[model samples]
Structures are given as C-alpha cells and as structure tokens.
Target: MATFAPANVLDFGGAQLIYELASAIFPAVKKMKGDYSLGQVAKLYYSFIWITSPLMFWGAYLEIRRQSDSILTKCKEKKIFFVLFFLIFSPLCTFILLNFSFESKNVDDIRVYLSFHSRLGMPVWGGIVPTSASVMAAMTAFGIRYFCCVFD
Candidate 1:
C-alpha cells in the first residue's frame, strides 16, 4: 500500500481545500458588497461551484488512477468497500448534482439564506451555507478515504 500521506490528503480533501480557499477570499467579498439580491447570491454561489468543481473532479480522478489496485479492489472486505464507496461518492455526486439543479430545487432555501445574509452578513461559522456544505462534503470525503486506506 502507498504510504504517502500528502497524496491522500489532496486526493480526498479537495472540497475542504476549496472551502479553505473560499473562506480566505470571502471576507474580501463581504467587504466589497453590503448585500446581494437573491439572484446575485445564487449566481455568486453557482459561479464558485463552477470554478471549484473541476478541481474536485481532478482529485477524484487522481484517486481512481492510482497505480496500485483501486480503493474498491484493495479493500480486503466487500462490506467496507461498499461503505467507503458510498461515503466518498455520495457527497461528491450530491454536491455536483445539487449544484447543477440548485436554482430549480433550492429556490426557497436560497431565498432564506439570502435574507439571513442580508440581515447579518456572512454566517459566523462559515461564510454561507454552501461553504458549510462543502466543508461537510470535504470531511466526508476525507473520512471515507482515510478509513479505506488504513483498513485495507
């Protein structure tokens, strides 16, 4: 098994990496604008997704392209493989599909989040719900990969 830690970090933690980038940049965004319309907020959020999705996909590609047996194959246990597969792919897939369908499926949530953003500025915990979500996505991705590698 490959023993390199950094490669795995990049391979699986893409979402968190993007989140950290966004977190670092968001203060500047907040400073540049006092408030945003629902549409503006949605556009900004979508734009971020569009920009970051490729990087995350690239990470997934790297993980799959590992020279050794794939994570699914390297696993000594079938149950563990399925579990890790679900944990890793589900969030990444959901994050992608949701972003693609976001405008249609999440109109109400966006409006509400926009209202909160207007009233209170960025959320104290994270810049926005999307940021929090991406963080969750990153955590899930990292957790699943770490388990798969360690337990395999």
Candidate 2:
C-alpha cells in the first residue's frame, strides 16, 4: 500500500482499521526458531531488504528519470540525487548490514551460508546475496549505469 498506491490519502477510520489489523495479526506470528534468535532473524530480513530494495527501487526510479530526461532537460535535480544515491548509498548500506550479522556460533547459525527459502532457514549472513532476486534486479536495473558513471 505504501509503495505503489494510487493515492496517499487514508481516512482516520481506514488507517485505524489497518493499524488494528496489523496489531492483531503480528503477535500471532512466530518470533524465532531453531538456533535462530532475534539477532539472526533481524540479519536475515535486513540483509535481503537492505541489499536489494534500493537497487530495485533504482530500476523504477531511474527509468522514470531517463524517460523524463529525454523529454525535458531543465529539472535535473532528481537525476543528480539518483546518481548520487546509487553511487553513495549502495555500498554504505552493504556495509551497514554487517552490524546485524550473526557470528556463526554453530551449525544452525552459520553467519554466511546459502539461504534456500526462508531467511530463518539460512539467515541474514546467508551466502544468498548473489543469488537473491533483489540483487539480480538491482544488477539489471543498474546495468551499464555503473560503467557509464565511470566514464562521465
């Protein structure tokens, strides 16, 4: 609802309804499993989301900017920020994920292992970054954009 919603407006009752639903539904969800603790869980979700969302967002974001660029050339502010964001933020976010990682205490919580399905299954430090769909999407989104940046 937050990302691609047609409009941002939400009535008080509707917002309250969503809040009520989320509050009720969240507590019923399981907290942690296996040797996986909250730290591990945090890493798992954080790793994928952190490493991936910006890249995916960039694809859409850049595409919009590029098309707009060709048609009108004056408002270059969004592109400047977009380029700066990709160049500066991606690596920074990548490093920040380390803070949330597990240190590999045992077989169940390898800090760097292959994540198959659930983040809890392989977890945050899971060696799934290269394999993640988000990573691929980012790579595809930023395709040639990186190299082009170097020349520019």
Candidate 3:
C-alpha cells in the first residue's frame, strides 16, 4: 500500500507557495496593473500558473527527462513535450475564459466596479474618494506601465 501526505498539509503548502509568489511579484504587478481590468486579472492568474506552479513540478519533470540517454536529446524532447502541452493548454484556457465570460457576460455586471473608479461620484466607506486623487492615480498608473513596457 502507498502512503501519502495529509490533504491539509498539501493545501497549506500550496497556499504558502502562492502567497510567497504573490509577495515577490506584487511590486511589479502593482506597478503594471493598478486598476481592476481584465488585463490585470489575466496577468495575476497567468503569473501564478506559469511562473509559480512550474517550480513544483520542475524537479520531477527534469528527472523524467534525464531517463533519456543523451542530455541534448532529452532537452529537445522536453521542449517538444511542453510545446505540445501549451498547444492544448492555450485552447483550453481560451475555452474556460469563453465559458466563464459568457456566464456573467454583461458589462453591467462589472459596472459597479467601474463606477467606483469614476472620478465624479460614489460614496465609498462613508466617504467619497476625491476626483483629484483618482485622476492622479490613473495617470500615475498609465505613466508607470508605459515606461515599463517601452523600456523593459
């Protein structure tokens, strides 16, 4: 019989790993994505999936690859494997996005968030955010993203 770690152990480990990744990435992410948009949400999700999750499997994948005789040949095989995986992965991602998107498809569904962003009105937490501060935040976010994209 095979033994396994407790489910809570695995869950807590995964959550800690994700939290660390978020903490490390938060500076750049905060710079690139300040507002609540689809782009910001996508960046956050993909960064967690691609950058963080890979480390969990990287050692196992490398061990599997090393089963092959030649180093160069094994790397080539691994690359091809991931490429094919991504070919399937991307479409599945799109399908999930499409289905979830259609479920709450209306722009109005997110209108409350958008309206909160407006500089004009909206009492939040018993006080309205000043228009000048909102405008400044938007402009700063735009300028930061622009410079980072253009230079980096």
Tell me the TM-score of each prediction against the true structure: 0.33, 0.27, 0.24
User: What do the candidate models score in CA lDDT, each in turn?
Assistant: 0.43, 0.39, 0.34
Candidate 2: C-alpha RMSD to true structure equals: 14.1
The true-versus-predicted C-alpha distance at residue 144 of model 2, in Å, is 6.2
**Candidate 3 error regions (>4 Å):** 1-21, 25-31, 50-53, 56-64, 72-152
TM-score of 1: 0.33
lDDT of 1 at 5: 22
For 29-97, candidate 1 gives per-residue lDDT tens digits of 232231334333333443354346446655654554463255445554565655555576657755664
Candidate 2 regions exceeding 4 Å error are: 1-77, 103-152
Task: Tell me the RMSD of model 3 versus the true structure.
Answer: 18.7
Q: What is the C-alpha RMSD of each candidate to the true structure, in Å?
A: 14.0, 14.1, 18.7
Residues forming the 10-long window of minimal summed lDDT in candidate 1: 1-10
What is the Cα-based lDDT of residue 51 in candidate 3?
Answer: 46
**Between candidates 1 and 2, the lDDT winner:** 1
Indicate the residue-level lDDT of 76 in model 1.
Answer: 46
Q: Provide the global lDDT of candidate 2 against the true structure.
A: 0.39
Candidate 3: residue 82 lDDT (0-100): 34
lDDT tens digits, residues 73-138, model 3? Answer: 533446554333333443454344323321222446543343222322122210211222223333
TM-score head-to-head 1 vs 3, winner: 1
How many Å off is the CA of 104 in candidate 1?
7.8
